[model samples]
Target chain A: MTTATTTDLYPTRGTAEVLTPRQDPVVWGAPGTTGPLRPSELGDFDRDGFLPVDALIGPEDVARYHAELERLCADPAVRADERSIVEAKSRDIRSVFEVHKISPVFAELVRDPRVVDRARQILGSDVYVHQSRINVKPGFGASGFYWHSDFETWHAEDGLPRMRAVSVSIALTENHDTNGGLMIMPGSHRTFLGCAGATPEDNYKKSLQMQDAGTPSHTALTELAGRHGIRLFTGQPGSAVWFDCNCMHGSGDNITPYPRSNVFIVFNSVENAAVEPFAAPVRRPEFIGARDFTPVR
Target chain B: MTTATTTDLYPTRGTAEVLTPRQDPVVWGAPGTTGPLRPSELGDFDRDGFLPVDALIGPEDVARYHAELERLCADPAVRADERSIVEAKSRDIRSVFEVHKISPVFAELVRDPRVVDRARQILGSDVYVHQSRINVKPGFGASGFYWHSDFETWHAEDGLPRMRAVSVSIALTENHDTNGGLMIMPGSHRTFLGCAGATPEDNYKKSLQMQDAGTPSHTALTELAGRHGIRLFTGQPGSAVWFDCNCMHGSGDNITPYPRSNVFIVFNSVENAAVEPFAAPVRRPEFIGARDFTPVR
Candidate 1:
């Protein structure tokens, strides 16, 4: 293992308050890396598997991040990597994955206190964003998603150890039905549901030796919705949603003339961080996730 | 056109109460075929894409329907249809599609007053179960679905005219996270969202004529969920969630040892009933949907 020196102590994406640099590097569960949660919020989170921090982020930060998203997406150099830039049915820019590795603004967004404090409270330890992305459903014809769970992807694709992580979705626009908003089943974190999808043992191989996971069938969606009942989350520009990784969730298409955008950061407990996919000995790519296990204050 | 005969007036599905034989054949939109909704409920339905009728169904009805779901799924005849029986990675039963056409109990579920009454109020006319199914995420290995908008399928494949329809998810048992509960983005009914999925115009010809609509990418889901947030529906047996046809939704897999079962019914306004898919002269198969336009009260 490499020694933690002052020069290379904090592998921070940027100067976001969520990842404050410590005088000394520490592993998870170390002191000064976390804060206490409000009793009521913790209770609700434990019971509901989700919580909302309404308007916790300031307007300036939201504007800055939104601008940065647009700037990065427009840069041709950023779009060179197929994995970083994804397209919708209309061929519009849909999402920018792994932005924390390329842009300081996005890196800072990952470490925001509004997200980290709650995540730590949920995981009860230090955390890192295993996956970070910005979903941009711009104007009309931005495609919607089918129903599936994130753990299904994390466990099947990344070999994540457990369902101990949380996902934070930070809204950059008015999230409404017309703009491809999110829908979730509450209290869904209590259990891990099985799934239907491709399971390639060597997906991350240089040759991409695995097939992609197929979407859940229509019959499966119809049945789950019947028993659980579904709900939507429409918040103003600066609100944030904290959800359990095991919760079953999905979103609609943005066929409206308006645009919908947000930054999504998936935080896994350092204790529960995944190794390489399919039991591989080497670590996964840094763009997907890093092997650095230092706790972020 | 052939005159409506008393013997075959309804083109009924079994002997369900909703399709009770009538001495005289009445056209769709006739009075007495639909009931009124409370003004408050109507307002809520207009504002929010969905509304829940809590305990509207009695315990006896719930039990009866649940039992029928189990009985029908196990029968070889019902499972014979490849489209009806779906499997997950774990190879357990995931869903039972087109239930209304196969079982009397499910046929009655199509016209459950709790569902039809409000549906007519929202639709402002008679309605029909264009599609009905039972999503069976049974205990271990029950698969979940990906996020998607249902109208994307209907409009592109079934020649549906508009979004003048609703889906009722009737809980046959307790719907929780472990069992792959239904989740939604609230108020997603305000506008029609574009989607990525199989476009079947060419599918019917065996030439692979049309490209399948792409699945919602990871970025798209993250953006929408951030803006709108998401919520789950967990209710006791017999409670139902009535949702807009265009809502973005999906569910989780059930790894737990508990089964999550529910019947799903999609009601389309008689005036808004679909024509042949993609403007084709021939109709889609019955197992997919019905061409019988006889209205149900």
Candidate 2:
């Protein structure tokens, strides 16, 4: 009998596909007892692997976040910072990592209870920012991310050993259905898809702009989508979605004039801090996957 | 009785000075049986906490490395790279992190058994690059680093939990006595000096150029120097020194016409991977302290 160790629980980037049952509990705390999430809401999140909340913040906060995003993108110093990943073809600012460190506005938003409380509830422990970024999908030929589970990449490259992390994506601009909004396969987080192919050396240098290393193959994507069905998230500004790290998700290209932007923050349980990568040649940069595990006060 | 857990073993940045005994072994293997370093050499290292090796690389390799350094410094793309840290006063390139990824020559040097074999022996396990950089001190008015234990700052900010790391400094230029060579307090690595004052938030942004947070006070420096006499290192190009992570060391400013340059590489054992910072509010960038723990093959 083949036994699995803690380190090799969800192995990915192997030669062939190997789907393992999700080993860790999806909702860490007992239903209804944790943070700001209600029992029904927690049940919905556990069942669907994603929970969408309306009016996560007031309209004023969304405006402030939007203004900060514009200011950051226009600043030359921020553009020069290595954390800013520029798109390959469009030459536009694709994503800015460590927004909390760069801007006080976002830093305040990160610590705000409205956002962090639910993450703490879902994660079931004191959490730290594993990674935080502002993704900018500009109109006119903006690229779309291929379908993949983030936990696959995080496990293979960042050395996160479990699915105890959660992603909080708050919409700054209106997420219209026609504008490239996020899409996820509901209930797919129950299975850990071990992707085929090795993560290229220094894959992060290019993967940040255009990722293909840990993306699911067509067969796997088709099966998952067919099994769980795809759910598109389209909502107004101030809406937010909290999704499990392993949820199969991706977005489309934004060719329309409306640019889509969101503040993406990842919270990982301090107990699940990273080690050496499972399948990657090296660990990614700190800005991409934080080395700090200090709990948010 | 206060029993120290594994995480809080080497506590630093506390208000009071706490000198913990070194818990891990200095050298991993039996002296004579280890890699390139001999028994006598290992004894010297264990006794003094530092060892100087003669002729680590031949003249041709030194010349090639020097040429590559010049080429990298002169390249506009490298200058623009955020990894390049410019001197505050001179505006000359001070240091460049992750040179292995940027240059094939340095990458090959990192993988070379001559440099890495000794590290594996001393660290007692497979080692990986915790950090790599080329430090360039321009001849006129280049600033010097203050006397401080690297482990103090590393533990406080970079989240390195132990002293199972060694720094390899290979001279790329002639190190004359007047040209600001490195100075160390011999045998000082036995005691860990927990410095006073909290680490300033986002200290790495400034500490890289002028560090003040984790440095020892003048009183502490006097005591350490008096207890263990200081030793200066002056050698020809291609000579190298391997020093413990906790060695108290610094250098003087370079005012002489001859500039001093060296390739600095830090190797940490995979068994001694980093965790959350014990004191610092946030972890430094990955270029400064790598999150990757993949052992060198």
Give the Cα RMSD of candidate 2.
Answer: 25.6
The lDDT for every candidate, in the order shown, is 0.62, 0.85
TM-score of 2: 0.50
Q: Which lDDT tens digits does candidate 2 get at residues A114-163?
A: 98889889988889999999999985446666677899988999999999
Model 1, range B154-272, lDDT digits (tens) per residue? Answer: 65456666667778888888875335677676655443444433344444333111113423445555666566666667788888888877666766445334578888888888987
Model 2: residue A242 alpha-carbon error in angstroms: 0.6
Clashes of 1: 28
Instruction: Give model 1's DockQ, 2 decimals.
Output: 0.06
What are the RMSD figures for all models against the true structure? 11.7, 25.6
If you superpose only chain B onto the true chain B, what TM-score does each candidate give? 0.78, 0.96
